[model samples]
Target: MCVCTNRFLRLLIEKLCLPTYCLVDCDPYGFDILTTYRFGSMQMAYDAKQLRCPEVCWLGVFPSDSEKYCLPQQCFLPLTAEDKKKAEAMLNRCYLQREVPRWRLELELMLQRGVKFEIEALSVHSLSFLSKEYITSKIQGGVRI
Candidate 1:
């Protein structure tokens, strides 16, 4: 489950009925990874719906969370040209507009801010900060979609 490859996830989705929650870095690549998990990749277009876990919701490390959680400024990294290109391509995906508008908004915010951070950024305060506080609070607070 750590990786979001469509072939493997297709099998997992077919066999499981549980909800899936995605926790990824607050970056274009990470956002793309989440999209792949929930929407499947174009390369696997024929099986996209079957592979996609539409029930999957993004659990953060969102760009906005860096400020919300007071993560160190040093943890934020500027988006490279390649990151911007990837994000722009993702922005054009039709499923984003039709299915996950809120997630799309978050991706837009990341592009607007031009910055990204890793899940490990939450650990600036403490090694267990993500597990003990971030993830727990986001889940309990119903902060996914």
Candidate 2:
């Protein structure tokens, strides 16, 4: 593959046919970040086809991952009214329903559970858990969506 330089991320990744993975928190905001990376923002809707990266995959930390990784109960924070509102609005996005139903379902599960956690929550096990274990295992085991 050629050096990427400052080329548009989506175009560069597509040109190189690179495998992309997005690791974000289990919160609504993190999900928004992931979707923005995949679909571009509403403000950029006009340029979406050229800027979007449809191949990018969700890597974590999923709501279910809290249980899978054995995070303690205290690490979870109850979703605030604002968080609930954001999540509810995201669930209505047509692209989520049409293109990534699994992701939409995860968000639904997060809302139903009424809790969210940051990526740092994995540190409860150990600081190294995120890079050395969680991300490594997720990719190696094909656990990402």
Instruction: Note the Cα lDDT for every prediction shown.
Output: 0.83, 0.86
Stretches > 4 Å off in candidate 2: 1-7
Q: Each prediction's Cα RMSD?
A: 2.4, 3.7
Top candidate on lDDT is: 2
Candidate whose TM-score is highest = 2
Worst 10 residues of 1 by lDDT: 1-10
How well is each residue in 1-145 modelled by candidate 1, as lDDT tens digits?
2434655656666677555689998898889889878877777778776677777889986777877888777998999999999999999999898998888888899999898899998889899988998889999999987
Clashing pairs in 1: none
For candidate 1, give the lDDT of residue 140: 93
Q: List the residue pairs that clash in candidate 2.
A: none
